[model samples]
Target: MRVLHLAPYPPARDGIGAYARVLAAALADRGHETAVVAARPHPSSPPEVLGALGDPGLPEKIARFRPDLVHVQFAVPAFGLRVPAVLRLLRELDAPVVATLHEITRDTALLRAPGRLLYRRLASRCAALIVHTRDARAAAGSAELIPHFCAPPPPSTTTSDALRARFSLGSAPVVLAFGFIHVDKGLDVLADALRHVDDAMLVVAGAVRARDPLFKPMELRDRRHEREVRAALTRHGLAHRVVFTGHVPEAEVAAWFATAAVAVLPYRKAAQSGVAHLALASRTPLVATAVGGLPDLFSASGSATEPREAGEPSRGLLAPPGDAAELAKAIRTVLDGGGHPLQGLAPGPEEVAARTEALYERVLAGAV
Candidate 1:
């Protein structure tokens, strides 16, 4: 099968980009010929509202690739106007299109009204939609939940001792918050939660691209968020407990996960998270917000718990969104082993690669 996998690819290392790159590689390994139509981020590429308008030569690039099936890894915010235009081109080509919706927010999320409208338009045109979690399915009109996969664990280059030494970290428990930095990811709340944790260090390993003028940075929202988070840490006198490693390479990330005692995805919203899935693949226990696709993703682990009988509380410590106090309590409980450990998160890259290959085959067969 010839497949053209589209989304934010390299040079823009966001989660959706990572997902597209990895998924395309996996599909290629499964015997399908895959070509990727990746767009560069603004300032780095061009500042056109639609990402591809900056790239005048993309259509010729797609025509040359001539894929049998086109899979679009669509994120409302990142693709900008390029997303809809890509869909329109695919429609003209009459290729079977599969759009994987990476997020779903009614309002006040990253994309705002225009983003949602664009996403809705793109989704409506696709032949099939792929969702990462059940929570995503609920948010998307009618999408299939094809569980997201992770990269294969890298060979152990450095032991825990070596990792600790490299980062100047002590023997204190390390809780990893890995992946791209964003306002909705609940980092500020996590920062506040750190005050309640004793002898535990939060290693935030991700890039801070949320509000940069180059790539749709939420100046007001993210700036205010960063300020409040710093203020909270200072108020609690816990400034020294956090290490912010802004966007390290992939090789370095594996070492952080291997050394950390656990991982966290305390998101304010839930569509689906590749971070949570990656943590599970890394064999690291996780404590995440009980919203969106997280509940379904971790439901297999017995880790997802509803604190209240329906409306009383969330199944997984269900804290109110943006509530620093509740988030702090949840992190403390998880570190202390009071929360669920999720012992069954050991899926390997081989398994993920196989499943992804099967999905590509299914899409190709149906489309052709």
Candidate 2:
């Protein structure tokens, strides 16, 4: 099977792009010929990345690949925030399309159409639609819940000790806020929560998502957001307690996760979180907001009232979204080993890839 994907490829610093790259690789490893078309694909992107999504010759490139199916990694921000343009592209494409709607906003501007929902029209054009969680599927109105990929930790060059020394983390317990910084990701909430905790260094593991040609997720998202986050910490007298590592290289991601006392996903809103998946892969205990798809990330939130079953290895704690006090309390619980880890409640990479491939087959045969 020749599967052509449309997404943001490597070196773009977008999570969806990384997800697409992982899925594409998994399929290719299974003997399927897979290629990606990113929006202005990074110059360093692998050969499997066919070309830029908006190139005049993209359609010709698709012809050359002769794909059996088109899998579009759909996130409005990844497509220059143009919903109609995505629909237009899907309509123009020749092969059967299975759009994996990455970010399903039930309350976004375009989602609430005058007469009909945007997803209604979106569903009409594609052979099938894939969403990462039940919440996303419900938000889409009609879509299947295909669990996102959560692989075991990648090989690491840096160890926990090296990370501690590099960041000057001396005996201070660390709370990691990983992934790209954004307003909705609730860095301010985490800062406020840190005020209630004691002796914990908040390691912010990434910078703001920059504006790329195809993935202009945050035109206004700049270093200012980082400054604002730092300022909030300063005001809370947590200036010394926060370490902002601009961008963690792939090889060092495991180290950050391993060094953390707990990985916190303080998102105010989200369709799903790849960071949560990554944290789980690294066996980091997590304290995530009980927002879209987050509750789904854990088998059970916390075992405060009841003890975990034998061999469970249960390890996540959840708090109400935007609640600083509750967030702090959950962090305390996880830090104390009240719960043990972030083993994903989702399927593994091979399983996710196989299921995706099956879906593609179903779509191509018009049996979906």
Candidate 3:
């Protein structure tokens, strides 16, 4: 099968870009001819650029590529608000089309009404629609629920000792929060939560790129948000206890996970989190807010609870969204080995690729 993948390719600085890289490679490994049409070509990406998704010439490129199927990794911001134009182009393509909707933010109907209408139109045109969480299914309408896929962590010679030494971190338990810095990630909440804990250091990894063409104009980097996070830590006298390792290389991401006593996802809101999947791949214990698809990921039954037993690693802990005190307690539990570790939650890259290929076949045959 010849497949044309549409998404941001690395080093485009989008998590969906990283996902495309993995999926494209997996398809190639399975003897399918896979090509990527990235939003923009980054120097690090292995595929050819077909310009941004919103470009008028995209239909011409699709005609030239002549793929058997077109697979789009969809995020509303990645394509912007110009859905009608993009939808028209997709309809022009000769090949069957499939789209994986990355998020559908629940409960903001007033703000998202227009986009939702456009999205429904887009979904109606596709052969199949895919979503990562059950929560997103209603918005996607008739969508198949496929869990978010993650590649296994790479083996690293860099050990916890080396990582701690490099960061000059002492024996204190480290709570890690990584990924592109954004206000929605709730960095300020994490900072406040850290104040109530004792003998622990916080590491904020990743950087905020100056411009993200994948995002809408209004969603560009907010330096003011970064300043607010720093000010909060300084005001609470946690300046020395937190380390900001801005924009580390991709190779070091797993090492940061391995070095941490626990990985924290203090998101204010999310449809699902790729960072949370990365933590699971690293086999690192996680503490996350019970918002969106997070609770589903951890098999969380209900509200926060004390870890059932010690030394018996399980699938991490969950706190209610936006509760600093509850988040603090969850972090403390994990650091003390009272919380479960995340393992075997998501499928490996190969399994995901195989399932996806089957879906592609089904969609092409109109059997879905």
Across 269-314, the per-residue lDDT of candidate 3 in tens digits comes to: 8888888988877667899998788887664443343333344344
What is the C-alpha lDDT profile of model 1 across 1-368, one tens digit per residue? Answer: 78777777765666787777666666667777777666554455322113342467767766776767777877755565455567666666656788877776523255567666776777766777877666667767687666676454455665778878877788999988887666778988788777677779888887656533444545456656666766777788876787777776766666777788778787887676777766666656677777676765444555544431233211223455677677778777766666654434434445655765566567667741
Q: Rank the candidates by TM-score, best first.
A: 2, 3, 1
Q: How many backbone overlaps does candidate 3 show?
A: 3
lDDT of 2 by residue, 49-165 (tens): 778756678778878999888888877666664456567777888888898988876235333563146667777888899999888787777777888877755688989999899
Note the residue pairs that clash in candidate 2.
Answer: 315-341
The per-model lDDT (C-alpha) reads: 0.66, 0.79, 0.77
Per-model TM against the reference: 0.80, 0.89, 0.88
TM-score-superior candidate, 2 or 3:
2
- In model 2, which runs have C-alpha deviations exceeding 4 angstroms? 81-86, 106-121, 212-225, 300-314, 340-345
Task: Estimate candidate 2's RMSD in Å.
Answer: 3.2
Q: How accurate is candidate 2 locally (lDDT)?
A: 0.79
In angstroms, give how far residue 265 of model 3 lies from its true place.
Answer: 0.6
